[model samples]
Target: MHSKIELIDMSKKNPGEPGIEIIESPEALAGQINKAEVFFLKNRKVVLGIGGAILVAIVGFAGYRFYIDGQEGTAQNALASVVYDFEADSLQKALNGAGGNEGLLSIADNYKGTDASNLASFYAGVALLKQGKYDDAISRLQSFSSSDLLIHARAQSLIGDAYLEKNQPAEAISYYQKAADYEKNEYFTPVYLMKLALAQEKANQPADAVASYKRVVDEFPLSSEVVNAKKYMGLLEGQVGK
Candidate 1:
């Protein structure tokens, strides 16, 4: 009986804050110099302290990047088969290992802080979820992050699903809301809102459920989820009306 169990971009071209803030020209350089003269005259110590901190940060970041690149290369090698195993639905092999190859869990731990390790954490969580290891799934999923909005939201949403399966509707509702809030887009926003509404309903929060469903209906009118969102909103609103 499948009732309402429905579940869940940064553009590379635009470099965002880093690109915009970077000093790129002589005219911009003159503006910065004038501002710096004013600022440095008033707060020389503060300025020096900030400059020192930034230098240290730059050095530390460079070192960390060098370290992680090597680690990620090795981890990627170890992870080549594990990712395929996971995608191929060979769940146990994805977690445990196969044919003398390391698994997602091992790559995550052995290559901590690398990009590959972060992906391993996500894959490991997903594998654990499929195997019904709900607690472990939540733990692993919570540790993973990505610059990609969809992946991050999906990881949080997967944690919600794990908690729901564990009969923890309150926790599920929390993560579902987090997922919905993590990325507000036409694609994933309504989908997560529907999940959030279901979790709210499960937790007996009719008002919240109604509000979430109404958000999907109003904000994402053309979404595939909006029809179900309207249906659920009406059901909850009727309950409140009664």
Candidate 2:
């Protein structure tokens, strides 16, 4: 039997009233369910996006660690081999290497992205310089760069020496200035300062030459370059007044 329904008086209601109604239609109910499912799907997408980002981060970190560890290992081994040849003064063997062994050139070529390769480039430049291949030395040294202050400064000094050997006094002076400014250490600083002063003298800039020599003598009196600096300073001083 149908349940009994009760109705309150509605005579006080305004005209054209649509009356109170309850939503029980099947299609309307289906639409509500569809909306709830859509909301859940949207939330699922957000969760998936966050999970994907975290997964990418984890994978990237692992890959970077592996790459760094591999590079470090390779660098240690490569440096050891090169150091042996360097100590023995085996320039040709060091650069070319024996069969089944890699040389500095191989390291520089095969491991270009690694720090060891960068160091190999430096050694190659030094080797070329020792062989009196000034142009090749300059090219190799100029192409190598590093963030390590000492290494970077030494490279610039080596490049300056290459230019000096090539009889390019102006270029040598420029590179010497760069080396001196790169590292504020007692060891290389005075040496580069002396070179700069000498180069300035060669370039006919006696005033600049005197200033550079004075800097070496005043700032690094105990350095080996200081003695030479003092003599140059005296000569430049005498010339300045004339």
Candidate 3:
């Protein structure tokens, strides 16, 4: 059984032919307009909320950038005397302080996230190493960061030297390898390779030591380390032959 459908005759006679009006009444049109207005008002609130969040993020980033710039300036000024002390071979004064000025330790602590602070970490680590504070040196050196490849490489090598002084040949070899591979250059590569070879030898890895030395001799022929690398490689190979 199907349901019946009804059709209403809305046509009215105005002349010979009838006409039909399908337009909404004024009251019905006003209702639709009101509904549209209400929808846009709700959406406007949501748009405003997202805009406010973006504004807050922008303001927060601006404040942080300002703070970092200020810290950079302050740290650079504070490190001046510390660098002088370090160059002058006053390792204690470089690490701590001399006279009324602050040293690398204080500067690094005060401006913890600045480039100058990272340099302070490096200076303080080297000062500690010179003072025979191997663990402290390692800690300070590891805290330092730099965008400059040469500086980063040197710092890694310095850490290896600290480990060597502590008689930890395995750790020394690890850092030496890191330094060698950190920034491959004619100057630093041969230097770190020599140190890596020496560390391998100290660790009783004669074969590995020989390989590292040969790399320096073959790849960095013009380097000062080449002479020493050739000498050590020959000595180790002879021992291996026996």
lDDT of each: 0.87, 0.82, 0.86
Q: What does the lDDT read for residue 14 in candidate 2?
A: 56
Model 2: lDDT to the true structure: 0.82
Tens digit of per-residue lDDT, candidate 3, span 148-171: 999999999999999999999999
What ordering of candidates by TM-score runs from best to worst? Answer: 3, 1, 2
The Cα RMSD of model 1 versus the native structure comes to 17.4
Which residue pairs collide, candidate 2?
none
lDDT for each residue of candidate 2 in 157-215, tens digit (9 for 90 to 100): 99988988888889999999999998589988998898888888888999999999989
- Model 3 residue runs over 4 Å out of place are 1-54
Best by lDDT: 1
> What RMSD does model 3 have?
12.7
Model 3 residue 223 distance off true place after TM-score fit, in angstroms? 1.4
Model 2 quality (TM-score): 0.70
Cα lDDT tens digits, model 1, 149-169, are: 999999989999999999899
Candidate 2 lDDT at 3 equals 21
| Local error of candidate 3 at residue 108 (angstroms) | 0.8
